[model samples]
Target: MSLDLAWRLLKGGGRKGLLSTWLTLGAVAVSTALLLFAVAVNFAFTARGERGAWRNPVPAASGAVAVEAARFDYVGDKEITVVDLAALKGDAPAPPGLPRFPAPGEVWLSPALAELAGELPADQLAGRYPDPKGVLGDEALVHPGELVAVVGHKADSPVMTAARSQDWIVGKGPVEVASLAGTPSEDSEAYRALTLVASVLMVVPLLVFGGAAARLTVARRDQRLAALRLIGATPGQVVRMTVAEAVIVALAGALLGAAVYAAAAPLLAGIAIGGGPWFVSDVLPGPLVLAVVLVAVPLLVGLSAVAGLRRVVVSPLGVAKRETPPAMRFVRVLALLAALAVFPLLSRGSSVGIVAVALGLAFLCVNLAGPWVVGLIGRVTAGTARKPARLLAGRRLVDDPRAAWRTVSGVALTGFVAGFLGLLSPSAFGDGQESAQLRIAAPVEQAEAVAGQARDRLREAGVTATVRVSKEERGQNRLVAVALGSHAGTPTVDRARTALAGLVPGHTPTTQADDQRFGLQLLADVRVGTIVVLSVSFLVAVASSGITAMSSILDRRQTYGLLRLAGTPLEVLDRARRAETLIPLSVMGGGAILTGVFCALPFMAGGVSTAGLVTLVTCVVAGFAGVIGAGALSRPLLRSVTADPAPRPD
Candidate 1:
């Protein structure tokens, strides 16, 4: 019986209900699709290194085989994950998760690296890999590009001998490498932090859009539910009915999103994750992920609906009274100021965790502060307005600033992202042509300990620095071992030495601009992913904002026509629509840009970043352009509303 009532209520909403439902579904679907896509891609990257289980067969006399262990160490000139292949049909079967084995002179590339091999010129390969030939194939062992190539040398070969002696190698001695396991590869701690940062960029606006869409036609919903309550329906029943409506819309959206994801997966399959394009099979998640998405999306949407219905739930009588909303808090602006104040703490780009956390905070704060800015704009516009249309638009905004802000919140967030991006743009790294080296004057026996100490200390110093060991045994074979590294600032070097004082004896120090090039390589990949995420988020933002604008215009159709019939000019109504959209957008959008810059300023090497400046300018220009465009778009609606000055019944 409740279900029938809920359905009838939705059906009775007519055009308004249908539009709201469509908008809500679209918001949910976009959010779901983006989330699923993000999960799928993360899996594609992170799972590249996880092997099931495999053990050493040489030591397998009568006991169970142990899984092979692989680790990444020495990241400067060349950092590689070494694997042991002793199972050679003697000790035990091949390593459980061995993707494939390369011959003694051959190397297998990860999907990402294979793509690189195909795309990059031969010269670039030579610079990264000396010989660069003997390419083979491996699925579960490498992290794209030249990271996980297997060598066929015996456990005691000179090549394996040198690798085992490195400070970063975890194992004591070189073992026969049956096959290279892919588990445990790159996407460093810094990388995960980056992922978090990226997810926030895409996910926040999604939450906002989804929430906003869920509450579309709040006034209408509240009034209808209040009438139901007055008719002796219990609050619980009314709540249940509203919730039922929310669930239906959410479920429909989730399904639509899933369909969109399924259709989009194949297209994304070709996007290179590590070094090569991921396979189509890897682009979609398992049944478990799908199940979670199905359940969670509707739950979130329903919750949003419930939150919006809070007013009605508390006092059903309020729905009929048209009470003014509480003024938007001025404290929201403090969030942006606080973010700016803390940004300069990130100057040297030393801490990835700090960087990611700070950026995330800045993004969030700017959004929180957006509404206050809208209210301010409304006040100012209303105060200064001389024209009737402008005055009406300003008054409406002053009357409901939260709604005014919501209409363009997406664009505001986008502007903030743009401001943030300008600060951290890849171009800031210059040509990324800097190179670095680390020379160790320690005995071969002490090399490993010294390297280990260096890394541990570097970690303490909050730097994601990678250390490299020499491939050749020439310089490092005797008392003086050579460990190469790139781009360590003086402070990082000093800290490393202090930590290595009693542990290992060695002195190695150097910082070159080119080392930033290596850093850029990592950031470049991350940048690509970030761009994709932001682009999607922006589209969703624009669409959602546009939907709200259209809905607002439609909802006020009668008021607009009445004013036209009374004394106001059609042009004035048109101007009012333009003013309402333009004023709040320009104000909030500007605030977002400033907030973004403030948050990003600290991470920026210098106070001013060219990219950020460009971004700020672009946002301003774009915001103004958007206002003009919005005004132009709203003119026709104004004309139609004024055409029949008489009130029309639904």
Candidate 2:
């Protein structure tokens, strides 16, 4: 009976309720799309990393063609990775318009590499590759960041046999596809773990937003449910009715989200992972993952609704009269301190995976206690409010602190993530060069002149350093120089770099600690990953901010009308609404950021980079600004609600 009544009520919801339902649906859909896309991208990256592992021993349809795959740092600096042409082929047959196999020493470069190297073949006159006329052709590649060239070799050649094979089998393979899933390398494991944590942080708030959307007009719902209580409906019956409504809405929203994800798959497939754009076929989750998401979202939504509606279930009179909720205590602030203590311990000896998991746990604790902290902040704000608008907003928050917090908690949490990510990515290679060894690579003919110019530049820029020609690799000559105290940026390194760029054909002077380009690329990758998640979180925050604020205004129509009747100008009420949104936003966001910085402190012992800190603050500010804009957009609703005073029943 309760379920039937719930469905009837839902179908009869007026236009406003219908609109809220759609907003809820969109929030859930967006969240679902993000989660599935994250999973798909992870799978794609892992598959590409394990590219050769599967095709190494494949079944033969009679006999299958096999090709070798070898990856090398094209320029010794790891600026880009180059694979032999056969590497991209996997177990596939020879591609049309290309040689079935190249004679020994022939190679193909990716367009990006060819562009960087001025279309030169693998061998002649470039920094590396060691041979000229060895370059065969160029091809566009996809799926990873910088796999830039492919050297080809004849089938069954001695060199080819020694190399690993990665051709996706065109014919049947001896090994089962299912058996080829290998454990990822430690690096990949750590990366995926971090990515998963970011995804969790992003999705959690969306889930919260969707729940809020479903229960939009909570005050109205509470009033109605209380009347149901007054009329002798059992508490269990009322609870079931509310849960049923939330579950049905959530289930519908989750399905809509799955559709949203499917529609967004093509866009996601284009994201670069290993060395190229992911194959579209690799960008969808398996059935198991889909099933879990679909089943779990509704159950989670239902439970949250039950928890939120407890006030109505317990006492009809209390809810109907708009009783104030219990004030939150200061203990909620301890979660941040606890997290601060854990981070230092984590920095000392924990693995990246463990650290990420612990960080996630700490975030959860903060989120759970966020409302309490927000409530305590309300008391502070009320005590401090001097302006009429500020005082009224503070009083509203004091009346229902959880409701106030929900308006901006999404923004607050994003700030928290931003802070955590700020110091989280230092040189993956570690800090302090210990020795500022500048590695110089130039043509054999220009080696001495380049070394001389490098030394002269260094001398001109600052204090002392020594320069020496290092060694020859292939056709290029090399030199190494050691400089004093430059793990921190130095003008000498900058000047030397300028001199080298003028001398070397492709000016890339590297450092000993900088080693290969891997560290820089890895840092870029980490930032990109964080940005992707943060962007989505920001969008969720803004959308929920507007929708929930509008819902709250509609639910509080009578209260606002009474305030107007009591001679509060609409302008003052409007300012109060803005204050209500911005106060918790600024306070909680600031706390969240502080908590994030505390979490990041141990690893950034030398202190956070000025650039990093500035970037994070800018991002957090931009996010809050967006939320504030959303709140502003909902002002018309407030005007409409408070336009006329409605008499209350005695």
Q: Please tell me which predicted candidate would have the highest lDDT against the true structure.
A: 2
Per-prediction TM-score, please?
A: 0.72, 0.74
* lDDT of model number 1: 0.59
Please write out the lDDT profile of model 2 over residues 1-650, one tens digit for every residue. 99999988787767755665665666666666665765566665555445423323333334344443333332323344433333322454432124444434665544455554654422211434433233322222334334344455554443344312222111112222222222344445656666666666676666666565656677777887898898898999999999898888888888988888888788877765433466566678878888988887788778878888778877788987778866666666676566556676766455656766667667666666778866766778789989888888888887877777778877877787788776665553554232355565555566677678767766765536677776644234444444545453444444444344324432345565445334555666776776777787787777777777887787777888899999999999999888888878888888888887777776574556665776687777788789889988888878876766776551
User: What value of lDDT does candidate 2 attain over all alpha carbons?
Assistant: 0.63
Local distance difference test scores for all models: 0.59, 0.63
Tens digits of per-residue lDDT, candidate 1, 55-146, equal 11132234422223343322333444444342244344433323334334444444444454455443333222334344444444433344
Q: Pick the candidate with the highest TM-score.
A: 2
Query: What are the runs in model 1 whose C-alpha is more than 4 Å off?
Result: 51-89, 92-138, 141-149, 163-183, 230-232, 314-318, 329-368, 426-517, 606-609, 615-643, 648-650
Residue 13 displacement in candidate 1 (angstroms): 2.4
Model 2 segments beyond 4 Å from truth? 52-69, 73-187, 273-276, 329-331, 334-336, 427-515, 648-650
Residue 465 displacement in candidate 2 (angstroms): 24
